[model samples]
Target chain A: MKIIARVLIILSAALLVVGATMAFASSASSGSGGIGPGRDGFERRPPAGAAEGSRPPGFLPGGAFGRGEGRGDHEGGRGMPAAFELLKNLVIIAVIIAISTLISRLTDGLRPQRR
Target chain B: MKPEHRTYIRARSNLLIDVATFIAFLIATAPRLSGIGIHEWLGIAFAAAIIVHLLLHWQWIVALSKTMLRKARASSRLGYLLNLALFIDVTLLTFTGLMISEVALPLFGLRLPRGFLWRGLHSTTSNIAVLLIGLHLALHWQWVLKTTARIFGLVRPTAKPRQEVSQ
Candidate 1:
């Protein structure tokens, strides 16, 4: 049982690492083309006539960034009010880290302390 | 009989179930890979795995919830919260996934009326859910390992319920 547990854990860890790296890499390479309401890459060129801070019309899937999308869109985009596309990636990274830490602490508590 | 062993068993079982489900999910989402027919079958398989996984963990879920309600410990509360988020995300992923129409599954004579909102929701939720799952694994990595070891019979189960099962 112990051996199986160890193997599963190792396998899961490997999967986790591979999965996350794949996701991050895909997101990075695919850029904004995959989904979300933002530019097509890491750096937005900002369409012609669009101001630095102002998002152009039709920039997002639906006109007016948070207007018609569901909570998933809101949460997925990190709920940045749609105006701050620059902060979108940052928000996602932060959320991942925060959730990871919280989960770690909780799971840690579930296990009995080792002597 | 040791606590570490118990912990290992529990964790390993959960991980095994999760991995199985993950594979199914990957198959289901394959259609997204090339907009092919293989995706529909995969989707069905994925959904089945989800049901199985849920059924397997039903007892733990009930116990976890009951414990949470009784004492409201910070850890238990956090687990419940994460569980809730995961549930919502997975539900949305499955829901939205089914919403998307595919040419591959047309032969099966099964269809769901396509909804633009559903498609949008599905894509967005899937992205978020993937991230959440990653975080979930990262947080529980240690337990995941301990359990895997036990499942493989490489280590004995913990004698007590409270002992460091793994370094």
Candidate 2:
């Protein structure tokens, strides 16, 4: 029973972290975050048909986000991305605790048997 | 070898690993501190080392948690809780680090959203975590110094350097 509990704890921790990443990844790809023909993941589409190089597309060229910086959302400091990041961070800490606990358990087996 | 010798060796080994992991963690977690891909891989390495560190101290942690519930000393309880918080913060650091990751996770094709929100949180939380760790170390400052001294063979040490007499 104890072993089962330990396994469950480890499993949950890994799942929490992995699940958050998957959710974030899906959300990103679902948006304009794809790599298609000279388009990096974070390209902010110009309004309908705006002239090239007319306005700064939120991110500076060779700036923070994946590809040069798309529109406003692609900027590293606003909207869904930030919100998602905060959410994912909560899961991240849980996952770390779980993994660390599991590892600690393994080390217990190696200790010199004490009376 | 005598049991005392074994104890000393074990203590020294744990200390060495702890110090090494800490140095690596500082390098890995520092944003853009090591120039590009270097920092990313170091982050992954930090994750691996952290688990090992926990494992090395598992016995004490387990013993303390059990005792804390039954009215163990306040200091011991504080140590357990402090360590717990540190580990959790570390997990957060790793998790958010991945989301806004420009290097490590990206190679595995794990592309997260484009925003500095995770990045910003990562920076802020890390700063807080570092401060907490400083306190944690301060609580154990004497032990750290003595252990380092013992490892260098400059001082003779007991199992705990200073064994606590039971009340």
Candidate 3:
């Protein structure tokens, strides 16, 4: 019962944040006359290959949802193979871990040594 | 449960939760590889996972909060601040994600207005979260290793590090 209460509190807090964001977004869009508060004027559109009605609602094949207009060319399927994309992300993470470890070590070294 | 046994169980749970959250983050980051559908759904699930993660460490969070501005060590204070920033960033990420949701929300019979600002913020926060996660993991890397070793029966139950509570 205690666990359940904690979960409920977290969920409620999250929902409150979500509600605030939605209200902000609604005002921003309204103020901009549907240009969507995008300084670059990028419009929100369905991805070109989404085939909205053709597939199951929330799950799509690799070729379908991640391609075309909604995002930049680099984020779509046209740029790289799936495996390569995953590899690239993993490599970024590896570099981040290395950098983080180095910073940690450097900080630890700065502290006075114990007798 | 014996105190040592209880500690072991907690350690195991933390390790599992951390690993799962990290994998989910990796997959969510590579939207093109996992497809936008999986990305959206996994991102929502990831939010839930994060809540659980925080709950697991709630006692520590409470303890640190009381002392963070008073007598907590510099590292603990730093970790707490970083965690606070991460929490705020994640809240923004989830909110922007929902605002620009393409798949998950639509499936639930709800559709938010198309906001290019929200989309931009979503992408930005997603990238920022990668760095925060890296730092978060780095801070807890020792705890992770020790817990894993204990779990595998390669190490005996021993004194935990002083800063482990911040983890």
Candidate 4:
């Protein structure tokens, strides 16, 4: 269990970095495009050479800094429902708690067993 | 088992939670990184954990306040002031953050015409909170290191709570 917990933490940390990078890959490739979340929790960048009125798939009108959006998870019509967002947050909390527990437990393993 | 050892374990547990929540806060504060959905949820979770941290230290907080009121040491007074400021800043930050939330509430189709100012306020106050937390940690550096050592068995838990000599 301790090993599994450690693996979970390492994988989640790695995934968080990779996932965030991939999510931003589009906007990073596109000049002057803001990074925003897609409906499926991945990021959607402005399409290549998109004009003012034209938006890429899952791109919202205002983008990340726009008035209608504020670092939101889903975009336009493709977004996961709000209920799902809550669930995702719950999952995040669970993962964090699990990681904390596992770490403490692992340290507990190092302690001298009391008679 | 000694009662103080129990307190030591409990304190270490709370500190562990505090550290974990801080890391989560760091990740979720990035608008682009965590997206709206994750950031809002993380914010809520962080807030809940902060409350728990405060509660776990309630006795110390109360005792510190009494000492401060009774003209306690300057260090105790400073610590108390720092904690109070941190609490206020976090409260303000959380309230402003939720006010400008775009994903967490809007998922429920609840939209409030949050002012553009909320964005700026939330960012600035959060930065301040971060700084305050850093200072708080630095002030307790000895305790952090010693307690962490105890937790990892590099040293045994103190048989008695350390005297508040600095306080």
Q: Score the docking of each candidate (DockQ).
A: 0.06, 0.05, 0.32, 0.04
**lDDT (Cα, tens digit) per residue for candidate 1, span A1-115:** 8546644643454356445533554465454452223321123334666643453221343222344232223222332343243244335545776677786679879989899
Location of the lowest summed lDDT over 10 successive residues in candidate 3 chain B: B158-167
Clashing pairs in 2: A44-A70, A44-A71, A76-B116
Model 1: runs farther than 4 Å from truth?
A: A1-115, B1-13, B26-35, B103-105, B152-154, B161-167
lDDT of 2 by residue, B1-167 (tens): 86677766777787788778666655544333354476667766777677666556656666776787897787677777887777667776676666667777778887755544455546665766655555565556556677788888888766443332111
Which prediction has the highest DockQ against the true structure? 3
Chain A TM-scores, candidates in order: 0.29, 0.31, 0.61, 0.36
Q: Is 1 or 4 the stronger prediction by lDDT?
A: 4
Error of 1 at A86 (Å): 24
Of 2 and 3, which scores higher on TM-score? 3
Ranking by TM-score: 3, 2, 4, 1
Q: List the candidates' TM-scores in order.
A: 0.51, 0.61, 0.78, 0.58
For residues B1-167, what per-residue lDDT tens digits would candidate 4 score against the true structure? 67787677776886698779767766555544556677788887877677766655656776776777786776678878988777667665676566667777777897655333345456667667656766676566667677788888898665678743332
TM-score (0 to 1) of chain B, per candidate?
Answer: 0.72, 0.86, 0.93, 0.89
Model 2 lDDT on a 0 to 1 scale: 0.57
